[model samples]
Target: MKSKGKVYLVGAGPGDPGLITVKGRECIETADVVIYDYLASPALLKYAAPTAELIYVGKKGGDHTLPQDGINALIVEKAGGGRIVTRLKGGDPFIFGRGGEEAEVLAAAGIPFEIVPGVTSAIAAPAYAGIPLTHRDFTSTLAFITGHEDPTKADTGIHWASLAKGIGTLVFFMGVKNLPHITRNLMDNGMAPDTPVGLVRWGTTTRQESVFGTLENIVERVRAAGLKAPSIIVVGKVVTLRDTLKWFENRPLLGKRIVVTRAREQASDLVKRLTDMGADCLECPTIRVAPPEDWRPLDAAIENLAAYDWIVFTSVNGVKFFFRRLFETGHDVRALHRLQTACIGPVTAETLMGFGLKTDILPENYRAESVVDAFRGQSVAGRRILLPRAKEARPVLPVELTRMGATVDEVTTYQTVQVRDNAEMLVGELADGAIDMITFTSSSTVQNFKALLPEGEPLERLLNGVTVASIGPITSDTARELGFTVDVTAESYTIPGLCDAILAHYQRL
Candidate 1:
């Protein structure tokens, strides 16, 4: 018989993927199967191993992927197969998430399980909207209640009289649809009609929205604002603090939808920076990086490392792939002791430094021309140099080095091929006029992105109002040659530079 498996009941936190607890994330990463809900941030799936089985049991409004009982059965079935299962639910699983029911079922089935509490939206939503649940001057007591109780029951479980008179603050979960009933019950139970109330929707995310009013008029106000379910309702003087404490919604790029056209593996840093600053980044990786068709040339160069005087790296990918191949071939950084290293940018240099090697030359700008200029002062009379980089990279560096009397052997370390996986969705978004800006980080990204566009469509008309941003002049030149209007170009030629340029462009507008 197989040994019994363990189940982890993990709370995935509020809508923000960053809000998840470290332990919860660990559960996701180590689990053999991940069963998640609708409210759980889809981004959290990135933590799961590639081989992990992912099942979505999302229930939103009236639509249900799997009912609560079915979900519980599925969990038991998976865990019974001796697999480590992670049940990922949105918010604090114990709080109105039916987690208690699931846990009880697991206990009856004799399954091993652990509970990982999550950041519930009841508190998180109000906090993100700038409303503190308690204040010394206003109220020091708080209570949490559910908005959607069983309609079939003859009596409500909530004690409205005590809640209105005793509690200093009230937070209701999933209460938007029953806003009128909630407000009326409070007023009827002697709560002041003038009591402040606020509702926050999709809180703690880029799409968070908030509305406020007094109990007497809040239902109408919410209706006029077009608020829906899956919202947090805060009832008390604490709701008034939102006017002075709102921060998340005030970010410079709060609602701007931007597209990032970099390779998927390297897009996270740029995506996080833009997301933190309040831009909703749509990752459309136009190019995918892979090993070259043949590794013999790179292997040969590595085998004869002693003959080279210098090894130059033009991009982060180049440095990583070269060092990786070197290690795979039973060689290490010690073999490069006789060679000087030159990297095009600080990022590439930093990557090289990770291998315990120091860079001899780093250009101020991250382009081939700047690398060539930086090499002007070096003595290259009859010196042998090895250059390992992308197959489609510009030849300016090698050409200029040859002019300075250096015999350069250029070998391909990586290959970048066009990816059209998201092309259809991209064109749909562009046609819908949903994208505000598109960022191009390299010439290859710009080229591949252009190829992804549908044939015979007027490019000018499709991207009419969308701003085009380039990482540097080289990328901007490529965009222009392809008939794209480059609206913003970074002066410093890096990811941070591109972000800063985009921020400045928006600020000026």
Candidate 2:
């Protein structure tokens, strides 16, 4: 007999990644294998260890990835192998998620298992849309029923009479397909023809769409609006609350698909900001940061750290690598007591300060030219400066310093390599007119992104309707030189500044 492992039937919450419980996230992080559904936020998978296996068994409309029986067998098989399995489903695993059925199979197989409850869309979708499921002023009784009833059953199992007349609020999931049938059944069962009804599609997501009409005309309104499946239907007077409390739909960037062109390691801050404002963010990391090919120059610089009068860090990567090697070779921050540090921007300076080092100079603008201008007014004659930066970076700073009577030793601390993952999906998004904007944080990002597109696909026509955003003038110039129209440029060349610029651009329209 094989030693059995534990299975956690974890609920992934309705849609928002933040809505996930702390316990649920921990299970995913420690699990050997995670079986997640389509309704589960992709962001939640980020918590899983890189070594974990991810299986998607999402069923939307009639398109089923894995049937229920297959999923049950897979869970039992995985657990029987003595591997911890986290079966992540959307909403509470108990609430219409068929979690009970899978749990039964696990029990029959004698597999150790536990259930972690999650926020179901039946409650969260309406709440995010600002419709309370239960209010004292309205009715306190609430009923949650599946919109998709089994056709093979002798009759519809739902008590239509009780739901129509007795229940104060009726919430149905996957009911868009049977909207007419649901409405007719309710009205015929003594429910008022004028009952207020609202359907929220893609609820609790950035792409959420809500349509409001009475039971008499909701079907027509839903048809005209072209709302599809994966929606929640709400009945009773609570439907009227949407008119006064419609908050999520009013978000500035809601429904806009924004592409993030930055390193995957560095895209989280920008991604969170945009997603918080209701934008669908796609992380297409253009450049991957890694150790330089030759560490001799940087290694030598670290050994002779006291010889240099000033150390100039052009990027956060530079500061990170410099100190990492400094400590690795048996050096510490105390070795820099006699040295002064200069940085290109506040962000770079902030990164430097993180090491308990003081910044002697920070240029007014976040550009190499600004760094040069700052040095132009200072005393640089007969000074030795050490610069550690990207291998492919421009030589503007070092070249200008050499001409200013300063001996400069520039070494590559890190290099940015291009990443081509999901380029096909990116091209498809553009072709389908799904992307509304693309943001570039650096010149390297801009160049690498262009290289990812299919060869000979006219950039002009391929990105005709999409807006191009730049972090600053340097990136904007690179974008323009590459024949992309720069639609928005940040005043402050930072991720937060870029977010503000993007929001302001949409507001102007």
Question: lDDT for model 2, on a 0 to 1 scale?
Answer: 0.92
Q: Count the backbone clashes (under 3 Å) in each candidate.
A: 0, 0
Cα-based lDDT for every prediction: 0.94, 0.92
Candidate 1 lDDT, 1-509, residue by residue in tens: 98778999999998999999999999999999999999999999999999999999999898999999999999999999999999999999999999999999999999999999999998888888999999898999999999987645789999999999999999999888888889988999999999999999999988888889999999999989999977999999988888799889888998899999999999999999999999989999999999999999999999999999999999999999999999999999999999998998888899999999989998887888887888888898799999999999888888999999999999999999999999999999999999999999999999999999988998999998999999999999999999999999999888999999999999999
Best-fitting candidate, measured by TM-score?
A: 2
Candidate 1, pairs of clashing residues: none
Worst 10 residues of 1 by lDDT: 147-156
Report the Cα RMSD per candidate. Answer: 2.0, 1.3
lDDT of 1: 0.94
**Candidate 2: where is the Cα deviation over 4 Å?**
150-154
